[model samples]
Target: MIAETVTAFNERWWNNFLESTNVLKKTNVFHNCMQKQETASMREDVMKIIRLIAINNIPEFGFRLYIEGKNIASKELSSFFENFTPGNDEKFEEWSERAFGDKKFGIIINRGEKFNPTLVEKIAKKITPLTEKVGIPRLGVTFTIFIGNYGWTPLGIHTDGLGENVMHFHLGKGGKTMYTWDVETYEKIVEPANRFNNTKIEEILDKANVFDFEDGDIYFMPYGEYHVGKSDELSIGLTLWFNNHTESALAKKLIDSLLFNNLEESYEILPMDTSPYYDFENFEDVKKLFHNNFGDKNFLTLLESTYRDYKMALYSNAGFWEPPFPKAEKIDHNLNFKIKIKEPFKIIYYSDSDSLLNLFIRGKKISLINNSSIIDLIKKLNSGEQLQKETVFNTLDISWNLDIKKYVLDIFFENHIIIVDYA
Candidate 1:
């Protein structure tokens, strides 16, 4: 019976579907025959729309914004505010200020079951068809809303959190959402020391590639890609969430096992190499060593197996994993630049002087070196010799701490250089 219900539910489209007075409507109708019961199809429809947009296609039509160009019914507005109870008037004011400021506010809505049924119904009716087509069932009928003011000042460049792909639909008379993926350009304007930190949202939004939306417009953006939005007037919109929850759950589990269960041994079997061989060593061997020491199996499999244990510990007892102390890497996109560390590490290249790119390894800045010096260092150090400080530091007039210098050397040691202890 459940299968039949699902089949019938999946086959029907809510917006155009008319509950025929005939047996056809009755076929999928919800009834405890002994007791009269009725269930609407909007919930199912909402699920369908999420599915449609998730597959990298904008649905044939975007979302609808029902507006009378007048204030929403006071009673309806009051009802809508019920679930949005302010912790205090000050808290409400704070939320409103943040939401209405020139910048975009991403309101991630979860626990959808807590919302009033009528509010849910209205949004569901508008969203169901699009979500249904996307096939992202995890999105269900639940959704999120992004609030903001009119114009560019309000929304800055930023990407959604990891694992969340959103189908954004505008729902106000003049609602508009703008976005783009030119994160490199965005970085030029908004400097996020580390993009993963949530508060860096403003910086991220500033750099996003921008596209504007009119009422009924829809756009799809996968997680990890940066974007931003603005509205011409007061705007309301819906963004459905679909993420790889299962994979994420497993990843968390695997991380927990690595951190807690085998932490002592993990340090022993660290993903490290001491072999003097420069590039000849098989990276696979290093990988296998890690697998053997950390717990036998591929990374993905290890994640899956360890997740259950992690879940138990995480839920029953509050436990979390702390990332290992950071290591840093320098990233360069300026290919035309030639850098040599002679004296002051002067770099000569035709890169956008205005662009500000952050180099990170494990979420910390090591330093930004001239690209030429980086290239020459790779070449000079690749001979696999313990590089002398004079040959290394003298070539690039950079001041260095003994430890930081060693850390830099470790990067070269991995593939390009060997530490020659010429004291």
Candidate 2:
């Protein structure tokens, strides 16, 4: 089962979550599976060390590393980060001995799934479905692990970028303690837009509220909050960075209008005014002239014709030209099974008349055929209605059309949409 935040973030909680600066949860998403990975990948483990140095122009009050309950001074980070030797086991042993053995703390910056080893990859797969269920965009989390016998954040107070975060003390014998200040107090201590002012730390230490997340505790930090933490004992933390995905419909509309336009059925280049007055410097000008003079008047009318003659089906991989699925050996539908759409997929369509229509599934257009006959079929499949075997025989009324089946199979291989036995 997936874990829940303290407030159970429904639509009603959006106002409070957004309006408030920082709210603390009662516990972290405590789990036992990630412990083995605590010492797993060294390269992934030490990824963020250099980013914490003061010379990086990063302000003192930013997401940074800490020792066992204390912050590492900026000047000391240089000598500390020199231990790792890229790709040499001998150098690594020498480095780890000096870095972990001498300095005693390690820094890792988990940017994304790019470095996902066995453990982090599994955690990502688990959380993806839960996010989808809650309408959250599936841009998975970043896993930054802190490894040390003693841990305290030397990064000082900081606010992460715009997104929610899950700080899980997934493995450790010690406990995690966090202190957060409301936005107002943080802004007063460090200028909202400027953190280089050498602000006194005493200002922030005064107004903060403290909380703790022991083993298995999961704390959800909503966006735009200032916080810092400390931990005792050998500990490993997996920080899951999450945020809503926002896409502007207008941008898509504009691109579609431009890429897909009305064109004349017959193409004949019009005579151009070669008087040098038509000279242009931009690509947009050439595009306008080309479309106006040689483009079709009803380009959409050619859509079906293009499909009929096309050798391969077009599967949308969001502009990725990956190979289309192999064609089925044969098309036969005398089966006795009812049909249903696959889980995690949705079929959507828009039609002027049954004969001319556009069908989309999982953000990809599946416009292989243009006919009113299949409209009923599309509706029934989307509605989760089970069809009788007779419908499959008919292939139009209670049945799904063969062409639809073929195209769906191509995409089903991609898992964009699927066909399944009726539940």
Candidate 3:
């Protein structure tokens, strides 16, 4: 029998859930998954995000607002933010109601991890254990925030992209209901062209597997399930998407990454008589081009190396598809400060060779000389211990130039791998 609900979510629970053969094949709800304090913290972070939207701090592409199921135009949104001034004590729902007047509206923010570091940290703490057990997917994970009082999902009944499953965390002053239909069942009832039809929801409502959840609850739905959400009252939720790409998709992404990293543009035009058709001799030229770009490495070797870098970076960023924005302010290396690795994230490193080490910090890679001192220092940081800036520098090899040590520290500071507390 399918286990439809769990009392809580944690590493042990996740492991047990996965052990079930029907794990991803069914919809599951986790009740009281988040503690009251944790839910309150999440609500606070979401409010800050809403305020960021009001001040235009969030990028245009990061968020979308819909009124009565119609997407608001960018210019209109800009105008709305320009005139939106909330009182210090004003709640988000209150502002949302005032902004839209009587019309029902929904707001969705993509890449929410970039906007709130605290939320990301909290989520990572809960999720890292699962990842540690099963490993992260090649394509990584991303999160979206849904906030609204809209009666139905603005997108209508839809399935996410291929190989994408979602875990929704409900943090609500209200409640939400979700309806899902398996692919085979949905296809049998809905016409091909009208599969996404929101207007016809009544016709299929009784056929769906219904789930209603309130604050501190979580709902998990597998990939390829046709689903829609209903929130008749003000509510907010965060959904994390775990993207498990098909082999072909993974190959395409790796090739794209390789090309992006190695391909250099040349302004020179090819000879007029150059043949476009491939011959054995031309194939040699192709091989030479690969060699020139990749230093005599075979194509497979190049792909393997690229995949390693991608995976390490993804893992280092705590499976976030997009890492958090870099630290905004410049670091003053000369001043004394306490530094430590950011919570729930650590520097990932592997030795490429006896002489070189590959380090990934928040999805950015940096290469360094493979020295014992440097490795030891990284280990200490990863241990979650705070260290003095001067002490960190002193821990490095004395033979190394002062400038090199400072540059290394600067990279860590800028990439947000290390949090600095000014003394």
* lDDT (Cα, tens digit) per residue for candidate 2, span 1-423: 986544323443433433442333322233333333442342233332322222343324333445543556655554444433233333333444555664555454444232322343345344444453444323324555655544446555676665445545344445677777767876776775654222244556668777765554455565666777665554556666653323443234333434454332346455555546565544343455435523564554444333321212111111111222332432234434555654323455556454555665533445545655456666666676756645633655336556565454444334334344433
> What lDDT score is found at residue 3 in candidate 3?
61
Stretches off by above 4 angstroms in model 3 are 1-9, 15-21, 47-62, 85-91, 265-291, 330-336, 351-356, 400-404
Q: Give the TM-scores of the predictions, in the order they appear.
A: 0.32, 0.43, 0.85
Summed backbone clashes in each candidate are 43, 19, 0
| lDDT minimum window of 10 residues, candidate 3 | 282-291
Tell me which of candidates 1 and 3 scores higher on TM-score: 3
- In model 3, residue pairs whose N, Cα or C atoms come closer than 3 Å (at least 3 residues apart or on different chains), thus clashing, are none
What TM-score does model 2 achieve against the real structure? 0.43
Q: lDDT by residue for model 3 over 262-325, one digit each (tens)? A: 7664555544446656534554433444437497787899999999999899989899877767
* Residues 61-102 of candidate 1: C-alpha lDDT, one tens digit per residue: 232211222223444444434433333223322444532344
Ranking the candidates on lDDT from highest down gives 3, 2, 1
